[model samples]
Target: MAAGAPRIFVSHLSGIAVFDPAGDQVGRVRDLVVMLRVGQRPPRLLGLVVELATRRRIFLPMTRVTAIQSGQVITTGVLNVRRFEQRPTERLVFGELLDRRVTLTETGEEVSVLDLSVHQLPARREWEIDRVFVRKGRKGSAFRRAKGEALTVEWTAVTGFSLEEQGQGAESLLATFEQLRPADLANVLHHLSPKRRAEVAAALDDDRLADVLEELPEDDQIEILGKLKEERAADVLEAMDPDDAADLLGELPTDDQERLLRLMQPGDAADMRRLMSYEDRTAGGLMTTEPIVLRPDATVADALARVRNADLSPALAAQVYVCRPPDETPTGKYLGTVHFQRLLREPPPSLVSSILDSDLQPLDPEAELPAIAGFFATYDMVAAPVVDEAGSLLGAVTVDDVLDHMLPEDWRETEFHLDEEVATDGS
Candidate 1:
């Protein structure tokens, strides 16, 4: 609690009150603002915004902070209501910083730096600070002034930052393009210029290159496929969804497609061929071969035990599908689905069959999109079992996968932000 003694982690700085020399509580520290420049190691402190009663706010420079103490903070000076100049929070956005100039301090001299990009890491991954990069400017005499000057810093030095992206550079843009999930990648591919997109894809690592290929639009896939090394292209196509692979291959020049397919692993090639055999819009084509199925007679406890051991994909529905063994299928009958939540609520040893919702609807391989959409909309199902004419389970169509097919091209970017506590300065 003593001033200048060991303080808590920066992440826990919010809500602690600000106090003057007399220990009178003035306001609560609200936000810590840092000014960033591209490629710099440390960003300059813009200031702190202190929220007070009557909707009043005060801005204090970093230098004014004296020491963080128990219950309150000590400041070098007090803020008077009449003298304070209040304004809405100003944030520099990405578009505004593109090709802009920023100031940087070197040896106490100020210089202009070429702003390159700004990246905001999400709050969840708050180990590093948000950073912006700039090309170092030439040294000049104008930098040293009477006192304070503006400057930018790099991302490498800061402890943590916002997940929301503000300013972006070509390099950061490519980085975002690489890390985004498949559906997101697909949506944004159209936003960048074709040349820029190709450049981004070319710069990607193997895993990321494969992911981007899997998500690209059909036309873009063909365009990029031709550009990739033959072997590399084959590897990516092999890793992609079968239907996606087949569609892309179908778009390639006949000779190139044949060569690529021949180069792919035998098993992967077969899967692609099988999917290509089906109508492009059919359930057989859209469904993933992997399914999490449990015997109709298994207990909830036993099913959960298996769930714990299985290497299931995150895309799958949590609910496990109940099915008759392949041997007993035609002779037996359609069972039902065991909802995952129900297992958690019911005591162990509850028979999965006892909890089975026999009213569970099923879809056929040849089912239409509208029928699939209707089933998903009506039941609020996360995944539905795809069955044959004889009620034999084939695969499943997950809710997320279906949405990928149905959702709009552009949605919100995955914004990152540190927790309020983590983003603030101490009292």
Candidate 2:
């Protein structure tokens, strides 16, 4: 759903068929998962518990969902088959919330929940329960419909659903830090005891956990990964950036690495193996296999659309790689680069190949850390493409990855504090 989409009542979504991009039904939504926040803030609609044809229930993340229409939910077709497990922080809308009695904040009168309405935030993928459909006088039973006034109220107009501000446990801790960036959240997780860290990690969604794991130290990453079930660990690894996932796998024992790789999707496993084949500090190892790749004839409009992806890092989005036939990594003969600034200046319909910066030399797959860093410094580039001896576009290395390798091993452990006075003056 886009900005200003009409709010959908949870009752309407019940038992809705879930379809893939191909329009084939994959499953039906059994329930919605939400994480309650501290205080009366609306709970975030995390994802859905989808029941497949085999009677197997799995988690379908909202990130993978493309649209929720009248009777069906359309997904990006990337479904993780692992069984859904409710964490300490997750609440099931169907099983826990509906038909429950809660108080109205305005009149202090108790109301029975009939249904809840959720809306996707404008310009964002996140959805939240924003309204409540309730009965005023009495709770309705399965066999009896009590005579009572029925009405809808804003989510904030009710109480008793959200977590308490002074609540303890990982649920409260997670709620408190829900808005923190992955790096800042990783820092917080780093300071926690191993048990607390594991609890918090388990409470986080796979995509979120993957982002935080990429920012954490190697030891922490290994420890947290070890604590999760093998299936879940594999899912989280698949969610991580290819290079980062490969780097983490490289730290594990050979047998453990092989086990996780076997559990991942074939395409992801292949990318991991390819990345792992490279020397740790080389261009191939540092590069992400999923950089935006466009064919020679792609237009400026196409390039801009790819760059606008919310999942892409600013460094990776700084430019796009133009290649031949195959658009994926290990693409057909590398053409050249098209910087973001150049894309913006060109007419939307203009061919990207026409404005390609072919003069800038791309890095060789075996280029070492020092040489790769030198290329970035000399070219003043945030990212540089990597090509194999055959001239196939392998992947692209961003300046951030270069810095990650150049920094001391214990650099992540160092605590940096900003002085309030200095920050005030600077601002």
TM-score of each: 0.49, 0.60
Please report the TM-score between candidate 2 and the true structure.
0.60
lDDT of candidate 1 over 148-237, digit per residue (tens) = 343445535322232232222233333323344554555445334465455546555556666667665566777777777889888877
lDDT scores in order: 0.55, 0.84
Off by over 4 Å in 2: 1-169, 416-427
Judge candidate 2 at residue 242 and give its lDDT: 96
lDDT of 2 by residue, 347-412 (tens): 999999999999999999999999999999998999999999899999999999999999889777
Which residue pairs in candidate 2 collide?
Answer: none
Q: Name the best candidate (by lDDT).
A: 2
